[model samples]
Target: MREAEEFVDITLLFGEGHVKCHKVIFMILAGRSDYFHRMFLTSMVESALNEVPIEEISASTGVLLVDYLYTGRIKLTTRNAQDLLVASEMLLLGALKQNIEEFLCEQIESSNCISLLNFARM
Candidate 1:
């Protein structure tokens, strides 16, 4: 369904249920920043997952993204980049891995052997 239809369905699904369910969901819609943030992050993650539908990604990469989404901080480095590729590769998350692979491949073509090598090794 389209976004508008999905939202309407959700509204109806909740509103047609227990009063408390409607109340709680309404409160979420009205005032929960955390809820919104979590949903926003989930949408981004899902889009990435769709780009490469794989079993899973590296635990470290998932943790890293989750941390960033929730806390807005990550100790990003030249290396976390490579690690993402490795994790994506292992998880067989094709769409997710494809994006990372594309980036690493470009780096390799440009002589960034370290990152490319790490990705290849993974």
Candidate 2:
């Protein structure tokens, strides 16, 4: 297991909700996503404060996104895959986005194709 304080230098606040992640690594985060890279490398407020507010995503999705940055893996299910896909796109995680897109495509059927298509278009 990894030590929280040893590697963690940033915190992500999810909306006005109760989720706050304090175990994010700058290198892994910035390396995996251009959004994170720019946020940390530039003179953005997030770079100075080492914190970011993500209002458009749910707390659960935010946790999954951070976990992917650290572990290179994420638990994607029908229940949360759409939210994860959106988060992955916002984070600029192309590989993860592709994986989720493939997963959704595989799950398509007459029963859910319309809903899935709407999600894909978003």
- Most TM-score-accurate candidate: 2
Clashing pairs in 1: 51-95, 52-94, 52-95, 52-96, 54-93
User: On residues 1-122, what C-alpha lDDT tens digit does candidate 1 reach at each position?
Assistant: 22223322222211122111122332333232343334334555532221222234444565554333334355545667666656534434354456666665655655677646664764
How would you encode candidate 2's per-residue C-alpha lDDT over 3-105 as one tens digit per residue?
A: 3444545568876553334434766778889988998888887877756788888878887787787789898899999988888888899999999999988
After superposition, the stretches of candidate 2 with alpha carbons farther than 4 Å from their true spots are 1-9, 17-24
Candidate 2 structure, TM-score to reference? 0.86
Give candidate 1 regions above 4 Å deviation: 1-60, 65-77, 109-111, 118-122
Q: lDDT per model, in order? A: 0.42, 0.78
Among all windows of ten consecutive residues in candidate 2, which has the lowest summed lDDT? 15-24
Q: Write down the worst ten-residue block by lDDT for model 1.
A: 12-21
lDDT of 2 at 13: 80
How far is 97's C-alpha from truth in model 1 (Å)? 0.2
Provide C-alpha RMSD values for all models, in order.
14.2, 2.5
Q: Given candidate 2, what's the lDDT at residue 32?
A: 87
